[model samples]
Structure formats: structure tokens, C-alpha cells
Target chain A: MAREKFQTLTEQMFYILLALQEERCGADVMALVAQITQNRVAIGPGTLYNLLEDFLAAGMIVQTKTEGRRRSYTLTQQGRDRLLMEKQRLERMLSDYRHMTAGTEKNQRDTAG
Target chain B: MKRKFEFNLYAPFQYQDLQDHLEKMAGRGWELEKAGYRLFTYRAAPPATVRYAMAFRPEVGWMDQLPTQGQEIYADYCRDAGWELAATWSRFPQVQFYRSRKQYPVPLETDLTSRWRVTAQWMETRFVDPLRGDVAIGCFFAIFLAIVLTIFLAQEEFAPPLFAMCAAADVLMILLVLNQLVVLVDAQRWLQQAKRAAEEGSPGPGGRMSLPWKLTTGLLIAAGAATLAVYVTNATADFGFLAPVRIAGAVLVFYITLFAAFRFRDLLRKRGGSPHWKWIVFTLVATLLALLSVELWDWFTDF
Candidate 1:
């Protein structure tokens, strides 16, 4: 099967989608992404706001609630599916790399002996 | 002692320049107090280090209720991210200012894509939409110019100097509009490149209007104003005080019609949720009313 566009997510997109798995406000999403990524991926306010707008527009996320000025959003079914697809794609690449490296290590050990 | 205020003008597209200027002002103990179209007002304050970041949001408007839902949410997000709302300019692009005192400035938009998207959206709504509107305005101007030319040509004793001056001014006005259209096209091209750069994860080149374009626009406006002044002076000289009075009335009517149309459009946007139709209707009605008022005044005064 041909992979769909955006089946592979950027590091920022992955963390953002991962954070949105549960309902959260934009500010909360920033915090969660920073925490989950251990400060390695920092999504600024502007990026979070625009990405959320894009996600909502693309039907990847839905606004769940609006409490005063803060709007809460969660991943839509499509978003979850995309996230899972990316996870599987990443897993396959890791598995291939592991297999290749394992064979090379074993061959090296045989040659050394 | 009262605090002193200073006015500074910056080009709208020079967002980086605006930020740097504001920072420089802050360091000079002149903190930004307000922002208007092409103008910034600063008040004297204790010297402090403040970093300014600008974000463009087109959904916000001057007439709309302050702290709108989207605006509030965005402000809160920025506040949480260490930025404090400093000022807002309710113009096209609808710039919002954020200031931070941190040692390292934290940008509101970290990714190039988001930054480009905001700017591109601003350009589309403000420039592109207006460019579409300009077509109708251009047609109307063409008809008006044709009528003026016909009236002058039909004169039994056409004075070449007067006709030539009037024709020159009309041409300049048309050229002004065309120059604006060119600027809009250039702006659209810049935005497209910016979007492409964003997609490639690089900061796009900032948009800037050409110096020649700016100078031409300035020249055209000055010429138009000078021509208008000359016409008014000649009319007053020939027709006594009545001419000035009539001219003032006409100018008043023009402004009043403009105010009413904008108010009507804003009112429709607030309630019925469709302002585009409001704009179209108001424009047509305003033009009719303006023409009718001028004709009726002329007839009543036996001019």
C-alpha cells in the first residue's frame, strides 16, 4: 500500500499529536509537549496556536470545550490513526536497523576469533 | 513634571524594524504607549531592557469587542510562555505586541511555517482582498474620468492650460491606483516565496516595498492634493464665499458617507454575521446619496 502524505510526522508534530491524545488547552499542550519530550522539543506559543488551527482545519483535531478564553482540543479519530501509522513506520525502520547491525556485529566477532 | 511623548513612523511590513525600534526606545527610557497606522507613541519611563515580538492575527479588528475569544486565548498562551501583551495595532495584519524581560527573548512563533502562515494569511486578507475590491473602484474611476473628459471637450472655448492640468491630475490618480495594484502583486509574490521558505524550515526574507514605489505613491498624493487646492482656490476666486462653502459641504458629505458605510458594515458583522453584502450595499447607496446630494445642492443654489 502506498503511504499517505504526512504518514511520517516531524518530531514536533509527533509530540504535539501525542500531547493532544487527551483534551488540553493550547497552553497545556505546550507544557505537555515540553514535559513529554523532556525539554528536547519546545513548541512556542505561536507554533502551538497555528498548529492547532491547522490541525482543526485538517480534521486531525477537534475543539472539545471552551472555558472562558481557553479552548480545549483533543485528537480526532483521524489524528490517532495517523499517529499510530507513524509509530508503526518508525518501528519498522528501527527493526531493520537493529537486524542489519546485529548481523554486522556477529560477523565482526567471527572474524576477530 | 509631565511625561513627554514621541511619535515614530515605521513601514507596516517592517516588523523586524518595528521590534528593534521599540527595543531601542525602551532602552532609551521611552516605553511604547500605543501603536497607530504608521505611527508609534512612546512615553518617558525608566530605562529597562524589554524584548518585543510581534504576531499577526487578522481576525481581530478595532471595532470588535476587546479581548475576543481568540485574542484572549492567544494572549494567555503567550503569557504562559513568558510574554506579556504590550500593545495591539488594529490594522490589517492586526499586529499584537508582546514584551519579555527574560535574558533570552522567547519568540511567540518558533517555527517558520507558522510564522509564514500568519503573515501570508494577513497579506491575503488585507492586500489580496483589497486588490479584488480595487477592480470595481477602478471601473468607477474610469467612468468618472470619461465623463470629466467629455464635459471639458464639449466646451465651446476649451482652455488648453486648464484642461491639461485637470487631465494631468486625473492621469496621476489613475497611475496612483495602478502603482498600488503593482505593490499588491509584488506583496503577493513575496508572500508566496515566504511560504515556500517556511515549508523548507528556513526563515523567509522579509517583505519590503520598493523605494521607487513609495516615492511614486507620495508624489501622486502630493500632486493630487495640490491640484485639488488649486481648483478650490480658482472656484472661490470666481464664485465668492459660496464656492468654499459648497466645497466644504461636498467634502463633509463624502466623509459622512464613508463613516456611515464603515459603521453599517461593522454593525452587520456584529449581528447578522455577513459584512461582505453590507459593504457592497453600503458602497452603492453611499455613492448614490453622495451624487444625489451634490446635484440637489447645485440645483437649490442655482449653481
Candidate 2:
């Protein structure tokens, strides 16, 4: 099977898409992402703005409402599917690492015994 | 006591240098009050530490009162992230935002690809578009000059010295235009290099105008002005009434062309339509104005 176009997501993109799971304004997304990442991953305004525009253009997100100067957006179904796929890919990597390490440790214990 | 002000020039592609320079100025108690094309004004203030970041937005025009929707949204996010919009220069398509170093500073652009896109857009709008326009104008002027020179040379009673002076001035004007084109091309090259570096997540080299090119351009302008003065004085003595009328007509055309250019730009920006039709309308209006001005001058002189 051919590889997916967006099979791998950058850390910033992943967090941004995750933050958009709930309908939030641009500022709200920044604050929520900061909170969720425990201040470890900080998305800059320029990066977030461009990413949102790209996402909106790609149909990954849809703007829900605009009040005054602020705009709020929510993830579309495609966006949610992409996020889920990325999460599953990350989980598979983690499990593979665990299995490899466990096998190496067990071999060491058998040799010692 | 009034604060002191200083003017400094920065190229559009010198974002890092401008940022560092602004930060250094803040350390020495100077704050940026306004920014313009090649000119930055700073006001004296108490010494403090501040970090500056520049973001490029090409969609915002110079005369726009309210920020565009995208700009407003971006500003809101930046403000919440602790960056304040300090100054915006439409000529350069950049917004300078700042925050105190004491506060946790958030990077304005975390990703390299987005940074490259911003810079690329600025280059295209500010440098590439203007260069294309300038080149077209330069070519038209060159052809007009050639035709006029040829006709002057063919005339039996032409003043050789005056004609030579006028020709020299015209040549200088062409040189100045060409020099400008060269500088713009250099700037575009620097921007392309910067974009490539951004793709690789590295800082690119700063853009600067060549010293020799600047000096030559200045010299050509001065020489052109001097020759024009000499030519006008000689022509007035020789052709009397006709010289003044011609000179007035030329001046009127020049000013009206400039006014038309600005009006067309504003119209296109505000209306957001096909530029081809807009340009044709602009040219037609400008030509009519020139003809009307020449007729008015003839009538006023007759009276």
C-alpha cells in the first residue's frame, strides 16, 4: 500500500490538532496547548496562525464562528481521523520499543542464571 | 525634556539584524517609535531589556485602518502569548512585536517551513512585484528617450551643447533606473537564499545594499539634476516661450503619472478586482489628465 500523505505529524501539528478537538478561539488554543503540554511544548503565534490557515485550507479544520475580531475553530471529521491515526502510529512505536527492550533483558537474565 | 530621535535603515530581509539592533537599542534606553521603508525611528527611554520579533504579513496594505481579519487574529494570539505589537511597516510587510526579557519569551514562529513561507511572501509582494513594475517603466522611458534624441539630432538648427546636456541627463536617469533594478534583484537573491536556509532550520545571511551601488545611484541623481538645470537654462534662452511650455507639460505629466499610480494602487487594493482592467483605466485617466493640463497651460499662457 502507498504511504499516506500526512502519515507523520510534527510535534507542533499534533498538539495543535489535539487542542482543536474542542471548539476554541485562536488565543484559547495557544493557552490550552501550553497547559496540556505542561509548558514543555510552546507553539508560537506565527507558527500557530500559519498552521491554522493551512489546516483550514486543507479541510482538516472548520472555522465555527467569528465574534468581533476573534475567530473560533473546531476539528473536522477528517482532522479527527488524522489525529487518531497519528496516535495509533505513536502507540505502535512505543509498544515495539517495549517489546525489544523486554526481549533483550530476558536474554541477559537467562545468561546469568 | 523631549526625547531624542534617530533614523536608521534596514533591509527587508535583515529581520535578525533588525531584531538584534532593536534589542540592543532597548538596552541603551531607546525604543522603536515607528518603522518605514529603509527608515526606523527610535525614541530615547530609560534603559531596559526587551526582545523583538518580526512577522511578515503581505496582505496588509499601508492605508488599511483596521487590521485584516487574519492580522487581528494573529495579533490577538501574540498578545495572549505575551508579545505586544510595537510597530508595523506596510512598505516592508513586517510587524515588529516585542516583549520584556524578564518575562518568559515565546517564539513567534516555531516551525521553519512557516517562517520560510512568510519571508517568501514578503519577497514576492514587496520586491518582485515592484521590480517588475519598475522594469516596465524603465523600458518605456528608454524608448521615449531614444525617439526624442533621434528627432533632436535630425533637426537642422538644434543647439549641439544643449542637446548633449539633455541626452546626458536622460542617460543618467536610465542608469539610475537600472541601478535600482540591480539592487532589487540582489535583494531578491538574498531572500531566496534565506528561504532555503529556513527550510534547513538555519539562520540565513543578512541582506544589505552594496555600498558602491548606493554611491553610484546618488552620484547619478546629482549629475542628472545638474544637467537638467543646465539644459533648461540653455533651452529657455534659445527657444524662449516654447521651452517653458514644454518643461511645464513634462512636469505636469510626471506628477500626474505619479498621482495616477498611487490612485490605481489604492483602488485595486480597496476594490479587490482584476488588475489588468485597473491598470488600463489608470493609464487612460492619467493620459487624459496630461492632455487637459497641457491645454490649460496653453490657454493660460495665451491670456
Name the candidate that leads on DockQ.
Answer: 2
Model 2 per-residue lDDT at B220: 71
What does candidate 2's lDDT look like per residue over B184-295, in tens digits?
A: 7667677777667555546554644567556767777777777777766776777685886677666676666555655554444456445566667767876777777667
Measured with C-alpha atoms, the lDDT of residue A110 in candidate 1 is: 100
True interface contacts reproduced by each model, as a fraction? Answer: 0.71, 0.78
- DockQ, each predicted model: 0.41, 0.43
Q: Which runs in model 2 stand beyond 4 Å of their true positions?
A: A1-7, A65-67, A92-113, B1-8, B37-39, B61-64, B90-104, B139-178, B194-303
- Candidate 1, residues B1-303, lDDT tens digits: the string is 335444443445567777887898889887777664445667788889989888777666534545566777788888998988887663432677888888675578877766776777776776567766785587578667856766676673456656655765666656666666666666667767766765665688664556756776777777777777766776776678788777777777665655565555444434543346655665787677778767755653443
Best by TM-score: 1
Collision count for each candidate, in order:
0, 0
Task: Show model 1 residue runs off by greater than 4 Å.
Answer: A1-7, A21-23, A35-40, A57-66, A74-81, A87-113, B1-14, B17-54, B57-68, B85-103, B139-164, B232-303
TM-score of 2: 0.66
